[model samples]
Each structure stands twice: as structure tokens, then as C-alpha cells.
Target: MMGGRGEGVGCVGGVGGRRVGVRGLGGVFEDKCKEGENEPYRGALAPALALALAPALANTHHHNIIKLSLQGNVGHLVQQHAICHGNLDYKLEDGQGPVLMTTVAMPVFSTKNETRNRGILLGVVGTDVPVSELLKTIPKYKLGIHGYAFAITNNGYILTHPDLRPLYGDGKKRRKPNYSSVDLSEVEWEDKDDTLRNAMVNRKTGTFSMEVKKSVDKGKRVLVLHNDYYYTDIKGTPFSLGVALSRGHGKFFFRGNVTVEEGLHDLEHPDVALADEWTYCNTDEHPEHRYLSQIEAIKLYLSGHEPHLQCDKELIQEVLFDAVVTAPLEAYWTSLVLNKSENSDKGVEIAYLGTRTGLSRINLFVVPDELTNQDFLTAEDKEGVFNADHFPLWYKRAAEQVPGTFVYSLPFNTGSENKSVVLASTAIQLLDERKSPIAAAVGIQMKLEFFQKKFWTASRQCAALDGKCSISCDDENINCYLIDNNGFVLVAEDYTLTGKFFGEAEGAVMSKLLQMGSFKRVTLYDYQALCWVFSESSDSGHTLLDPYFAFFSAVKWILTELVIFLVEFNLYSWWYSDLTAKGYNKGKRRKRMRKEDG
Candidate 1:
């Protein structure tokens, strides 16, 4: 939880002055000011206490702050101001030993033309934002019911996580680690491959899934569940935001019978109104939302075993009925459909009504245009005729499921251009007056690129409130995907691989990738190999050893060489002495022999 000081923004004055002042719309630090008995400071009440400013603060540069403020669309202040930012740190209060905070300062610099304080440092306006406040809203935003959010720094250190324990030292020495030292890998026990950690630290935006084991019934039983993760780096900051969802709890799709017991409470609301009460929908207002019955829908509803509708009017009416009934979904559709990509031409390419008869049916589909051209769809008043063969094959597969269940389709081609697309459909069982079931389903189709971008942008949006920073997800190293149970690529940054087997693209077994298992092994192997190669090389800069170890190694080599040289020199001296003695003896013996012969 954030302290009161962090809830609202404030300004701190007098960085280089003898006294500092704090002010804000919320009257920040007003109580402390009132308690002071000293003379008034900054033309207001004096602060309760005076503290010494650090000498290092005098030489700080603030150019990044200006750039961030501009990107964040920050409004101008009444007065001119300069900017400065600080790293995460701990501030010890009178009673509190230490509290972590991030300080950002906006300074008022002396003008170049000023006569008295020309080009000199002036007072600074800063705020102490507790780290808790910086990340307070993260947990509230989740991927699904069992989803959660976590953050990490550029170095892979955990910033905020559900399982994080900030305190480390024991007893009187107990204190928070320097700016969250815990690594993300510590709590993500199932992440064996280090894929999530590496990708996030490297500032890539993507999604992936893993399996997690949980104990239930007081550890009597264990359950293996799939966990999905979406992550992206915050722009202009050293942090990344991630959201994880449990497979069972997240409503990726609905399965089994759609019952009244399963709440559609929003639909029951009186405020839930239709686009057009008389006609199911008006193509003029929402042309993309209303499509003429696809040949697939007509075949299923009109020519199927039950033969529910006899004529084209009946089929068209069914389309209108489905469209009007699904009005509650407009808000969601609008957000997704209207969202355009960085490339203006690309967006949610297609949104259509795919109706079929039975107790279970897929009612609507929002997809990218197969032709990859969204503008062509509305350029002319085209006839409402769909190619008889163009209905998605996945639609039929989805229609086979019981109402209230969700279905995910493999990648397929649409339109003559053969662009690949994926669909996710949810089935709804509509009830008649006597409680008989009529089928209804809502589905969406997205281009691989559009789908990937949508989720990546979602992760980057986490830094929206921090006006001084922006998020970037366009790194070439970015590789993330939405995968299914069997490791099939669903949505991926690499759009070409959409709908392919994950193993096929990655060339690894599913078990190896279970929890980034293979990735971890690869990283370890690379590390060891590099260590071995660099160990044999003579490059001191690239050597793994620290300066201390290098110094000791040099000393050891010199000593070894000195010992060998001394032993060799001693042996040579001994050999020369022995040879000289032998030569003198031989000469004396030859002289004695010559005298005896004379």
C-alpha cells in the first residue's frame, strides 16, 4: 500500500538552499509546516525539520526528464522549471528506519541573462514517491480470474510480486534489500528455462504459457495447471510489467451447456439495449458488425438435419436476431475492432455474424480481412453474398461443441490473398419461452500481426500514468506467443508461424519447453562454454576473473618462474666446480709420470 504522501503529486523546493519547502494541491506536508516554530520559509510556514542536502546533487543533469515529459503529454507549469530523476532509494524518517522511494525533481534554473544569479544553480521542486505507490495499481489489473501482475527491473530483479518478501536481515538488523534484490526466477518456481526472465529483462513484449503445480486439500492432492503470461517493458524506465493467468480459471473459452445459472447478469440489465430494435442492425451505422449470412451459416441452419429455416428471409432474420441480441458485446467489439495498428492500413480486419441452428452455435466472429485490406470492405456497397466455400472450417468444428463452451481454431487462410488468420469462438445456448435451447456463439478472428501487437500494447500500457516514461515493444529480439495445451502456436509475434506446431518452429520437444526447461539448459551450456573459451584466451578485459584474482594469478606465475630459474642456476654452478677439480688432478698426475721416466 502507498503512503498518503504518494497518493497525490507534490513539489519539494530548496535543493541547494538552507531550507526546503513542500507544496501541492492536496496541501502535502501542511501539518508538518504548521508544527514548525521557526521563521516562515519560502513565504509560507516553515518545515518542521531542516536537513542537509547531499553534495552530489549539485552536478545532476535532467535532459531525460524533458524528453519524458514531452512524450507523456504533460501540461506546462505556471512557472519555468528544469527536470531531474533519481534511482530507487531508502529514506529514513524520525520513527521509521527506512522507507523505499523514487524521487523526481523539477528545478528552476537561473536564466542566462540574469545579472545576479546568472547561469547558477537554483532551487529544485521534487517529489518523494514511495516505491509502493509506483506499483500500487499493478495487482488490480489482471489477465483473468486467477491472473496476477508482477514487475521486475532491467537487471531481472523483482520490483513487486505477489510472493515477494521485502525484508531480509534478521532481528535488529532486519531491513529491506537495496531496491528489491530478489530475482524473478526465485518466485517463478516453475520457470526452469529462464525464458520469461530473460525475455522481460531484454525488454521484449510477448506472451507464453507454462505449467505450475499446486497443492490442494491441505497438501493431500496436487494439481498441475497451465499458466499463461503476458509481458512488456515500460518505455523510458528500467522496469517491465507482466500479467499471468491460470489456465483453469481464465475464461479463454466456455465449455458445456450454457445455463441461466451461469450469470449473464449484464444481459439481464435493463440498460442493455439494441443497436436497432426493429431491424437487428443497421449496416449504415456498423457495416462491419453486420454481415450477410455466410454460406456456412446458411448450410448449417437451412440445410442441416433439422432444417430450421426454409427461405433466405428466415436466414437473414436469424442473422438480424443474433446481431441485436449480441448488442451487449458492442463495447468489447468496438475497442478491439476500431483499434488501428501503427501501420494505419492494418487493424482488426474483419467482424462478422456467423449464425447456425441447434442448441449450440457460434453467433459472431471478429477477424482481420483475409485480403489484409480493411478499406476495401466499405469502399462500395458490396452485395451481402459470402463465398459458399469461404466459411471458416473451424466454424463447423466449433459448432459441434455443447453451448457455453469456447473453441480455439488452428491457423487458416481466408480470402484470395491467402493471408493467415486465427479464430476463437465462444458458444451460448439461448433459451425459448418453454426453456428450449437455441444456439448462440461469439467469435473473433485476428491477423497474427494484429493479435500480437494488441497484446504487446496492452502490456506496455501499464506505464500510462508515469508521464515521464514511455513503453517500447518494437525490438527485433521480441518473440512471444499465445500457445495452446499441446504447444501449438496460437498468436505469435512471428505471424508466419501462427497455427503451426510450436515444436515445428522451435524444433524442440514439448516436454523440453514445459517450463522453459530447454531454454535454461541452453543458457547454462552457453555460459559454461564461454567460460571455458575465455579461460584459455589471454585477453584480460574479457577474462571472467576479477581484478583481485588476476593480480594473484600474476604473482603466482612470477614466483613459479623464479623458483625454476634458481634451481637451474644452482645445478649448473655445481657441475662447473666438479669439472674444474677433475682437470687439475689429471694435470698433476701427468707431471709426476714424466719426472719418474727421466
Candidate 2:
């Protein structure tokens, strides 16, 4: 029996009715009895028993008695025995020897919708070309069907070429056959109160609905529902306005034939004005058929003073290029007036040019001359300066180059630098090269190291405090995992956290977890965490446990050390440490002197 103090007894053979009990062997064991008794045994059963069980006991106790001298010598034999028969638990533990726990409640798991809600915007650029022409160009450019494009406008009206026009023809060719209009009795319904059932019951018979549906289907893109009256209803009657609306229901509603002079009057009281007299009307109902005149469309196109030409390949390119050069100013001005009217003190001015996949934005920042020259590039092209202490004036100058443009400004405190520009430019060289605006914007705000550290630390803290640390990989293409305070993973087997966008996805996940109100702090594991976790696993070949646990523990230790180093160096603070400390010390001395004088 294996017990405390390693003491046990085994039976020895008796000689001729007399029993002999042996104590310590010291390399000698003998059974002695009377001379007349049977021949005394040469070897004692106790010694044999000890010899047989010693090897097994040594193998079992080798792990616990690693520091023992004899045990060290039996390392190879013990290891061999363990490999052949022993099962071990090799889970890693913290320095304090506590079992590492992970919580699924960490702030890093979220749905796509929730991620978008946290200031993620998806933008698409559109063109006026017919679906057929667009489709032809799509493959040539190697562009996604759901992407950006320069609008083709002739005299401010979207140009439609003959090739493109073929895509938009008579209602019969454009619309799908409405089998939805079949009798309700012939159709199957799983639920009586289903919205689809209701839609079938109220089947719309208007040609406009068919035309709109056909356009949408041809576009082959998901249409986000906009509640704006211009895009939805005309006097409460549904009418499709083919334009993308901004987040706040704002859109560019072009009136084809009406002049600016006539537009102002129509906008004031649109109900009384004839449709031909107005450029665009904000109404909840579709205009009457007789009111849709060709002249109105023509005037609206001409109002912007844009050149008109018969739609052709050359003409299309010319119009598109012109729109690209001029659209930025138009977009900027529209944003400004809307923001002012809304009484928003903090507004962002944006000038957008190009299409969805090749878009660029010019952000204007207004700053004083002194700070501006140091921080941002000047339009004057000052040499030898690589950095700016404040936003330069060049962005405002860029804004001024176009008409009706304005800058977005927020209220500022006295003596503070008022504005900063963030110019987000995407490589328009090709469709595939379009950078994600969301990613670019976030990239500017914080360093990748800072983000990674914050995420990993937060995750570890959450796991330590909570029993379960929940982690999910949004980008399945990449391998990502959350490490516990001891660096073990809570994820299932066959999953790994690796790849380029893993950190960003982890950040997004963390944001969602925060919203769900599960865990307060969440951190994303980075390469540093990976290194720590992996190195420890490689070192410990004796312990038998999940390799993930060893890694998790190492990551936790690494993060903990990083946090300590940052705190010790005062690196977490934004201020220049040496200068701030010096200034603070001076102030303290002055205060002490004044107190002594008093």
C-alpha cells in the first residue's frame, strides 16, 4: 500500500512451525529457525516484496520527489514508465499556484450589427450608367458589384447611353412576373399573421413598384430602407427615389428641369406648384403621371450649369470625371448647412470624391497660424519640416477651392488648439486596393501596440475575476484566442487565433461585449501573448495537461509584467514624463517657500 511515511508489512515463509520476522534488510535478509526444522530460507519474503514494489513506487513518486538524489538518477526510467502507463494532468498554474479561470463574459464577443452600431459605416459609390454597361465595366475593372463608381452626369443629369438604356426598357422586361398576385387560397401560409402573407394580401398593382423592384434587382445589391420622404412616399404614396440616404436621412434629391429660382418657391409650398415648375419636391406621394414632364427633367439637369451631350462612351467618361472633380465641394456644403440647422455644436466636415472602392475624403481643420505650421503641412510647401504641432491651414484652403464648401468645427476652450484634420485617402489605383474607411479611421486614433496591450490586459483581468472568459473569433480566417491570467485558452480544440485583422476583430468583439453588460474589461491577445504562451508549453515536457493551459498562463504573466513596467515608467500618462515632473517639482518648491514667508 502507498501511504504516509512509506511503511508497510509483507508475509515471509515460516520454518518448520516457527515463524521468523525480519526488520531492516540493509542488503541482508534471512529466515532462521531450529536446526531440526526445514532448511531456513535464504531470502526473506519482505525483502523481495520491497524490491518488487520499490521500482513501482519510485516511478509513481518521481514527480513529487523531483528534488530527491536517487529520484533524479531514475529520471529516464521514470519517464519511460510514465510514457508507457502513467496519465498526468499538465495544466499550468499561476505563480500563486491558483487554477487559471477564463470567463466568456469578457467584452469581446458581439454580433456584426452591434459592431456597426459602434460607429462602423459601410459606404458604396454609385453611377448613372445602365445596369448592362455597369456590368460590363465591373469585370474589366475587376470590381465587386457592390462597390463605388464615379457618377456620369450630362448637364447635371445622370447620362444614360444607348447601351446602358437597353438595361432599362419597357415595364414588361424590367419587372419580374408577380406570381405573388396569385389567389391567397392557392398560396401556402405557415403563419396567418406573417408579414409576407399581409404583403401578398395587399399586393401593389402600380407599374412604379414593378419598375423600382426591377431596378433594385438589377443592381444586385442589398437596399437599405431609408425613411426619408423623398425616397419613400409622395404625399404618403410610395415612390422609389434611387439615391442612397445618409445616416441621418439626408440625401441628394436632384430636380432635373427646375431652376434654383423656381425650386425655392416650390419648396416653400410644394402642394400648389406644378411638377414641371419644381426641380425636386420633398413629398410623401408620387407626383401625378401628367405632372412628370420631359421638360422638368431637362431643366433639372441644366440647373447646375453642367454641359449636356448625347450619351456615348466618350461623353460618359467626360461627365464622370467632371463629377469627381466637383462633387467634393457639393457634399461638403450640404453637410455644413444640415449640421447648422440641426443646432449641432460638434460637426465633422467631409469632402468625398470618386466611387465606393476608390473614394477619398478631405477633412478640414482650422488652427492658429503658430500651431498650424508645426503640426500639419502648409499649402505654401514649407521644407525640412516633417511633423506639425497643430492642424495646418491647407485643408481649409482645399475646401475653399470649391463652391459652397465649409469646415466642421467644435466649440473649443480658450488657449486650446481648435481643430485637427484627418485626411483619409484610399488608393484609387484599383478596385481591390480600396482601404476600409472604418479601419483607417480607427488606425489614426491609437497605436496597434496600445490597442493590443489594453485588450490582453483587460481580458486577463476579466478571467481572473470571472470564472469563465468567453471569446469568439469574428474573422475565422485568422487564428485568435483569449489567454487567461495564467495563459490558458478557454476555446475548444481545433480553433486558433492568427491572422492580420484578428486584432481589429478582437477590438470589435470587445466593444460588443461592453454593450451587452457582461464584463467590464476586455483585452485582445497579441503576438506577445502568443510568444509567452507558446514558449512555456515548449519548456514543460513533463507535466501532462492541455498545452493551451500552459500557454494561457504564460500570456497572463507577460501581460502582468507589461502593466507593471508601464506603471513604473509612468508611460501610461500622455504628458511628457520628465518635463512634467520637473515643472511639478518647481511648483512645489515655490509653494513651500511662500508658505514659509507667510
> lDDT tens digits, residues 486-545, model 2?
112222112233111222336676456556763333221111010112343556555448
Name the best candidate (by TM-score).
1
Consecutive 10-residue window with the lowest summed lDDT within model 2: 229-238
RMSD of each: 27.4, 41.6
**Mind giving the per-residue lDDT tens digits that candidate 1 earns over 397-488?**
34334455656654332223335555566544443222223244456555555665677777566577665334345556655666654345
lDDT of 2: 0.26
Candidate 2 residues lying further than 4 Å off, grouped into runs, are 1-202, 205-598
Q: What is the lDDT of residue 329 in candidate 2?
A: 52
Measured on C-alpha atoms, candidate 1 has an lDDT of 0.43
How high is each candidate's TM-score? 0.28, 0.17
lDDT of each: 0.43, 0.26
